[model samples]
Target: MSTEEFDPSRWDGRDLPYIPGEFSDPDGVALHDDYDADIDPVTYEVVRHSLWNINREAGETIQNLAVSPIALITRDFQTGILTESAEFVFFGQYLQYFSGTMDIFTKWIMENRAEDPGIEPGDMFLHNDPTVGTPHQPDVALVAPVFHEEKVFAWVSNLIHQNDVGGTVPGSFCPNAVDTYWDPPSIPPIKIVEGGEISTEKEDLYRRQSRTPQNLSMDLRAGIAANERAKGRIEELIEKYGATTVKGVMRRLNDSGQESIKETLSKIPDGTWRERAYQERSMTGDDGVYPLELTLTKEGDELTFSNEGTSEQAGAINQPFAAWRGTILSAANVLLQPEQMGATGGLVRQLNFRPEPRTITAPDHTAAVSPSGIYSNQVSLSMANSVISKMMLSSQDEEIRNGAMTPTSAQWQCHIGDGFTDDGEYFLAPMTNCMMGSTGATPKRDGRFANGHMWIPEARGPNTEEYEQSWPILYLYVKEHGDTGGAGERRGGNGGKICYTMHGGEMELGVYTTDAIPKTPGLFGGYPGSRGETVVLQDSDVKDRFAAGELPTDITEIDGENVETVGKGPAIELDDDGITEWWWAGCSGYGDPAHRDPELVATDVRQGGVTVETAESVYGVVLTDDGDVDGEATESRREALFEQRLDEATTVDDIVAGDEAVEAGGGD
Candidate 1:
């Protein structure tokens, strides 16, 4: 599988060339003789723990050494170890989506570059092509091959989100671009290191393509260092236990993971669960909202996912095949095997995807995939969770259903700007505050508020003081928005509101890609969360108000000559008199709000999470003058609200009867 032999145009996006035969084997295939004969239980445990620790250390090393805020603050990166066959053995807890990507690129290296570049110790490969394995162009992967006894034993990999990679826009996310070429130049599997020596030409070429070359250079070095550290630790393990024993332990880990997933699947009842999610093509405005539908079929020990009725590729919102697969894998890891780290390869073996080429979930080679990596990939994961939750809820197993959370929001809004610092230095980067958002509610508990990203809960926004100290900006306010989470019995988490203004220098703010879209939808009878808001105020009275010892508690109270609501576009200028405010959408809730307890509603009111009017109207809870729950009045109000809801609801028979009844029932 040379570079010449591989054709991106011919790829259906369903199959990768490097996946092992064991991944396709669902009948519990026996291990090789060498794997079965030489490994003891104690040695296997030692090897497993050693590999996990190496992955952790690799992640910490990248975070400590990288200069980008994306790594140091938001932690938008991952490190993992893969078997010689490209199976994911140990994945760091940083970012889940990058775990599947490790398998994709590692296999690509083995198939195409094994003989050409000659895979050996100290040889490393770099690639970031969404058509092959990467989720998007911004995420670059560095893979190093480890060898013991003069043969390839394992691979260590690192992936990071570079802020600027020489794209049409300042950030790699090019919302207005119509094709892949408009984004950064795609780097195929190229040898950046050979025999412990760096390829200066390749490194320079990679860095020269970024608007912030120095930042990219630092990130590249950090990735290489992390991979090298992991490689050294793996070699140390092989030195202690023979290479054959280490390989045997890796095999045993995969086998155990397979058995665990199979056992879990057996508990789920055989059924076909269907769900549909929509993505707005606001870049073109008229392109309309496209649907990404999933029909998950569970049979015995296998689950098949089909995107049969998804919209075709039309705009920049379309995603590549790897994103669809990686997002699904990420969701499965959290939903099915939350407690395990070695089940990815085995899970991929048990799962299958039926995707149509040219669709949003499996875009063609010429389709634009950069801008939609964060948007469409998150939607795909939410769609996966929708069907997965349905299956889990329908199961008789308590543990499976207990593990489910309400559907998560996949859309993350990022703000990037570039300008001169107060010290006469230039800077351009994404605000790490974009990482803060709400998480979905669970069956028994409310969602976590501002608990970082849904995909990587450990990743969080930088502190306000730290951000202001680094950049020429003043923080007006950074706090959780009141009453923004969806209203339900068990309410969703609240998203945050951030307002900032230029301090000592002027900068150009990049237009956001996501706006006013309900990406995180509610489940059952719960209401969906509010749409995200982005507001810009030019020549505002904020400075005057600050001088007068007054600060606005809300964005609408500010006075400005020109107020604008912006979405996907090119960058715009901002002066010292300008202010920008962003309020992120909250997570979805679990149950009906009318059934919520009055005491809980009163508590929410006391905490400023719900207003008195909203409590009475939405939750049917009446609060007295002293902010205490009026139990009698609340019960009467809830009874009336329940009756009104019953009158508006349609029965299952109406849906079965089709057009006339549905039309009369006002079904959309």
Candidate 2:
């Protein structure tokens, strides 16, 4: 698509930045920003920490109140507190990306809907429109304005991934989506709960598009309850400390976060860092590999990001501008200013996003964004993590460099089961075991194994027993897939693998994923980790073996013909006789594997985390039969590997000289 063919500004707040002011469309709503109270140091600390705790508790409220697997079990929900104008002040410990997107969603509400709908007291707005602001359509948000003396004092918001919103497929993730229209309905901010009461009509309207209406309906109440619970706490604090005093504390927290980040950035040298990643295949029945690149430029105390060289938005592998920027914000929060926890509003003030409007990283509203959360947006997460880590690594200050790490585990794989339960109830939910992704290797330590996703580090998906009860399948094994982490001075975390088969009911499994090939890059000289793929073993003997009282742990042990190996595209379904199995490698490494201590490699071999062949070829470590390091042999192998690498590589000096000579021969 051409840049001239698309205009992002026409579709609801698609291109607006969050700037504090009265509503342009609605003027009657009052904003209480009177920060005149003189709060003592002790009082300020008390109120500041109290607000943070409130946000944290609100997130837990969602977990307790909702029955959706993504909510109660997967814990994919996030809650946050924003200023009356929608600038994030405190974010809970959940999906870090939601904090950024919610800020955008609420600011859009203040800008556009405050008049017709009226942002009155007791009103709460719900939304999941990627154009208006959300990572994807499945993540629905509820925002309530905390009114103090009938003025908007603050806003409390929460969003959880619903089980199903109406789409061509179950789980609302259409990997084969033709466009955003083919995916779930994108609802902009609407009054889901009005005047402190559940609007039954609006709630019906909200869940009308979902395949699993009961699940989405309950999730609706979960979000509303979370926001109201948080709102009550905010009101109590305002009553106890006085609105002016509490507002002053919140302002100070923002100021502290801003100054802290500024000080950290000032310590680092000004420089630019760039990283590139690729996503294979756009939709089902297509074989296309597209590149996405991110460049970070830091000058003085501010940082700027650009996606200048990304490919044009295509198929399901595209994200809206809000999601693209949200990935950046999540990275900044974790790597740059983690000590200031959820103060992304302050962090964003020092950051600017300059995006090319037509690219996958900043697509127009017409692109299929539902799958972007699992695919392309994650590519953005990996790139931003790498560039920021590199930039932070350049700092002379040890404290600044302490925060640096390689690219995080940004890859994912999943199978959504759409089938009838043995008891006659129908179901549509993900296996969700894919949440146990590995973390990237850091400079001084190995990445933690099965640490879940990089975006929401806190989420550990439901247990195996829960999966069996919820779906019509039985898990053969859900174990760590060893030897998948990239080889380096410190190995990356290990990815997870699982095998399963049909048990008692009719079933159809929808496979949704991105591949492990052209893998997410490793930092320094470390090799990239393997990307994962999903495979179906059709008409397998695994079930027959189960009848014989023997279970299989290895995919190789299953005697079956491979039906199809799927990547990032349309999902393929399967019947009861077929078996499904898949695995993902850990995030990439942090340094040269050859530079690693030989003993460490041997230890990894002993633990089954590294294969003996990999130890020799990749790490140049020779291990004895007893899994001990063969020091003399290791020394010889390391020298040979180093020499072999030099022989296989082209010299940079030679290339640079050739370029110079070509420039000198301008006449020719």
Candidate 3:
């Protein structure tokens, strides 16, 4: 395919089933194609199992070896196994976006570096440049090539989120960054390892850009070690099954995955679904709110996502193209084709992205994408989940409709702080309590309470003890935040709230976040999730109470000076004595709230998942003094609520309601 004939709009969805890109050059990928050999069913299945386990084990290798708290606690890293041509065969289930970038940028490296330095055996490359298709700068990837008989045979890569890289602020969210110049240096793929040896010159150059050089060194080792493990396993399998059979298995897995998705698409009706989300204040002192939209169209057996209504590249909340594509791919893999086992070459092959290259969802090289991990990526994921779920819900197949998932991780918030401990030790870290975000509602039932993140299925927050062991911060409480989810018959999951004060240190804490507008959308007539808030109490005497042997849990009772933070803000010095209270809301609900069951409402009230006041007002439920649901009062209250809605409603001619809706085929 020539550059003149190739069109991004009419992209072939089949390349993902094997190679993620077309073979514009080196169609053989520098060696002969042994994958064309006829493979027996037994050998293919065995090798397929081996390939999947290889990637999963690679992730375990990183998790066990990485010293980064983000990797150990939140498990916010990913690993992948690619073909000799950098086509992904199996990617870890941690962060789908990481694999998405790994696919794109590794191909970029192959296209650009094949001749100069060459793709050699026992060599590994490091990449995390947004301009070259990385989602963000902190998400560093290690890509290594495997050789069979002096020819490129396979590649193993892993990406992990670092706590901090050199930038305007700690944790590298960089809210003050107006452009890439102010961001952590975006490094493209470079040979970080040569002949199985760490390149000291390259390692020093990379480590010098991070605030926590020690941590960076350890994580780099972890990435290299993960690739080494995967490489070893691939070699062992090749030796056992023969390279031709192993390569045949990689080829066949993508073929089956692609066929599976196409079959599913053949059943569902084709249509377009649109979802919109908002983010307020790009940075501190910026009051403008921005709009981001996703238009997902299922045409025949293919899907195309377009960001037609999103805002232009501006401020610091913009993201690269890979983030948008990754969010969609994650949803399609989990909800549409979980059976594929992350052999997403086929799932991605069935999808296309009509990216708005200069928009917030697909910003250009000049944009500040450092904050994307917390801002732009979340909006894209939430909107993608919404649009994709709507498409599946409208399908005639019940299985497809039920496969629709609500938001897993609606948005990301970073409660990052850096300061000096009493012993004069420097500390920079993020309180991952926010990783316990709200899960979205499902068609079958309500969403889970702080279940997990959208993109990361295994996403979990660290234990309170873990933070205490690592830093001088004391958590007042990390508890369920009630009434934070949307109200409906099947309510959205509840979110979590964390309140903590500096104990034995002086810190500069900053809340770099999003969801000034709820990212997850409620389905049917369900209500949207509540917005998030970050508050700090200044000049507090909470320490005095702690000294008195009184452990305070309620933040409102131990208040001093309450300072609220805007969603977007510039770099600044915050009060050291302030206790940060973070409230991240939950996913959106499914169905109408007033029609919810009184027994469920009563149960929620008793369990602290919902307050009694909210049950009565939002759900129109009545409860007795003993906490039992009052059935007669609830019925009467529901009746009154129906009448009140009629009284307050304005007249409409085209709107369908009551028996008219039933006659118009609108009633369920």
TM-score of each: 0.92, 0.94, 0.93
| lDDT string, candidate 2, 367-441, tens digits | 787877678777788888899989988889887776777677566566776878778888886767877767877
Q: TM-score: which is higher, 1 or 3?
A: 3
Which regions of candidate 3 deviate over 4 angstroms? 1-21, 27-29, 570-577, 651-668
User: What total of clashing residue pairs does each candidate reach?
Assistant: 0, 2, 10
Off by over 4 Å in 2: 1-26, 514-516, 651-668
lDDT of 1 at 221: 87
C-alpha local distance difference test of each model: 0.76, 0.79, 0.79
Could you give candidate 1's per-residue lDDT for residues 208-244 as a string of tens digits?
8788889988888899999999999988988888777
Say which prediction, candidate 1 or candidate 3, comes out ahead on lDDT.
3
User: For model 1, how many clashes?
Assistant: 0
Cα deviation at 456, candidate 3, in Å, is: 0.9
Task: Show the lowest summed lDDT stretch of 10 residues, model 1.
Answer: 24-33
